[model samples]
Target: MSDPHLTPNWSTSALLTIDVQRDFLSEAPYGVPGTTEVLPALARLTAAFRTARRPIVRLYRRDGQDADLVRRTLLAGGAAIVAPGSAGSAVAADLLPPGAPPLDPDLLLAGRPQPLGEHEVALFKPRWGAFYRTELDELLRGWGVDTVVVAGCNFPNCPRATLVEASERDYRVVLAEDAVSGLHDIGRAEVTGIGVGLRSVQDITASLTFQEVS
Candidate 1:
């Protein structure tokens, strides 16, 4: 496959915000140093996705014995934000679109679909990729989503891993540079090596006209 950067039409792509919950932000237990810098861009991307009526998948790790090792490690370091029923486990208030419904813990934990405003929905990921042992693939298939625009939270772990997995699943991928954190230039190059599109939130927002995908 060619690099997705050469493709101009990303309107068919869903915007995926990986682990943008309170835990990864500056004020949360699992805060990454650069995480706070991306909020404004993330907000812009979220609004764009919502307006386009494109799919928006928010990935979160729940705290439990069955939780992924990363969540357990973060919790051990005093990042208690991923606890299944805790308020801190909830998505960051800023990331929620205007008039979006509050997260339903019961529905989320039960693996039921919970709507996020009109164009978005919330799903809890059991592992790094949204596809790992989850219904994200099914959901995307149902929506006929072929491309994925990924943003949010640290890069070394979740976002990076998720991108690799998405590529393996044959989805055209774009990584929103400004809406993610913990990514160094070298790491960015690694993603580009795999043919994932590397773009800034500003770049996409400035030039891309988001039309509703059928």
Candidate 2:
């Protein structure tokens, strides 16, 4: 597999921002350490993708009655994390571009895409992997995206699962190293061994080509 880090075709790539919702950044109860630390890098990359007119898919988690057994067990005990329509379920306000619509929990939880901008949309993933039982692959295909750049909270969880799934499906994958949490050198080595290209947000932003909006 060719390494996307060396020659990223920005025009053929889409950015996938996974599970960066407010709940995941809170202290205790639901917080994932290191998530908040990556916000600035994620924001910058998001802006660059928006400027370049490339597809941006924001994948948020929404826990509902149909959630997996573990999540449902937590919810049964009255955990309020990422429940649909709750403030915690919403994407971080600063990560959104100006005038981007708030995530539509109804549409997202139904596994449908909610338009957030001309080239950005939000989708909900019931599981750790966004491609599992979701329309993500089809949506990316429709937009002509052959490669996926992934960044978001918790590397060992959603982000890692999504990266592996993307690779299994044969999409050239790039892991935005500085823009994802829970990442360490060992994990980095593991993914790289499987042909996942790793790059910093600065490198990605510099390689992107911006298209002026009329």
Candidate 3:
């Protein structure tokens, strides 16, 4: 349970951008306050991961055909938050690499990973935790990633849930503090108590050794 941020290995680490979709940011029906504020930091982190050739998993939240009771109720009530195939369900354009392939709701809802770039892919989560019913763990294992660096929408929900799930699975977890929303001192303490290390985007980027594109 040592601090993974103190001595990091970029090669074995993957950056998980959780729920950075338009539906979860300000002005959206289900927006999390301060979600939009973290975009610049997340953008920096994304670029750093791309340059380092580390894997990036952009986890999006989607309303599935078999959504849970809460979501089903909301949908029945006419809330279109993150409804599949809606514009609001899309990942923010600023967060995606230029020319990144459009997200396929069918693929995502079916638990398939959509390729974004050489070392990046997008997958959809059915609920608060990315690992709940998704192939995230398998995908990371296939990429040989032993550490997870998480950033995005809201710390109280998806980010926190994903971090705990990663820790439970024995993956070294690092929280990109400034690149996520809804994080306060108490929430951070809760995360660190569970052996999750926290670092700012700058600290993470500085730890990486980027190679020249060949």
Candidate 4:
């Protein structure tokens, strides 16, 4: 690792926006509290990443007929919000670009990338971490990405899980504090101890100019 005083140089980074779907943002289903409160910040981060020409991957969850359906059913209490092709399975309108490309739930549910924005692709994750059971590692490696800028919903669950997995794989990780939710103080402390940079949206935005889109 480079010296800790170097302001965390990111040679190549991908913005991994995790589980910020309709269900998790509002009352659609399985929504977390405080998620709605961070809408502006999340939008700002998304714009910044797009401007910086960094790769942005939208991590989505889709339900399938898996062996663990019984457990998922129990955890969901028999109500499925993020099921494939469901309205709640899509990203929230606020987070999506105006006239963004449509995503085929089936393709992503099968663990594929669906093109979204200029340099952004949407990938369906079978579980919390984008690295688990997905081609995120190969994709990042192919693009020569080194650092991961993570933002989105429910820090205690998928967000936290994904960050840990990224660190284990030797990627420099930065968690945008204001762009995510569901983080308790203890959890925040734990992430910081692992060398993850916890920064606010405005501070991150200030570091670079956004790219000019045609």
82: Cα error in model 3, Å: 1.2
What are the lDDT figures for the candidates, one per model?
0.78, 0.86, 0.86, 0.79
lDDT of 3 by residue, 89-133 (tens): 888767787789778988887789999988899988888888888
Tens-place lDDT digits, model 2, residues 1-214? 3644434557789999999999998464688998888999999999899888889999988776878777788888888888788888888768887788777777877778998878888988888998998899999999888889999999998999999999898888899999999999999999998778899998888878432332
Q: Candidates ranked by lDDT, best first? A: 2, 3, 4, 1
Whose TM-score is higher: candidate 1's or candidate 2's? 2
**Order by TM-score, highest first:** 2, 3, 4, 1
What 10-residue stretch in candidate 1 is worst by lDDT? 205-214
TM-score of each: 0.88, 0.92, 0.92, 0.89
lDDT of 1 by residue, 1-214 (tens): 3544435455667888888877667766557778778888898888777766677888777767667765677567764566776766778767787777767777787776688777688887777777787778888878888888888888988899899998898888889988899889998899988878888887766544534432
Candidates 1 and 3 compared by lDDT, better number: 3
Instruction: Show model 1 residue runs off by greater than 4 Å.
Output: 1-8, 70-79, 210-214
* Candidate 3 clashes between residue pairs 3 or more apart in a chain or in different chains: none
For model 2, the superposed segments whose C-alpha errors exceed 4 Å read 1-7, 26-28, 210-214
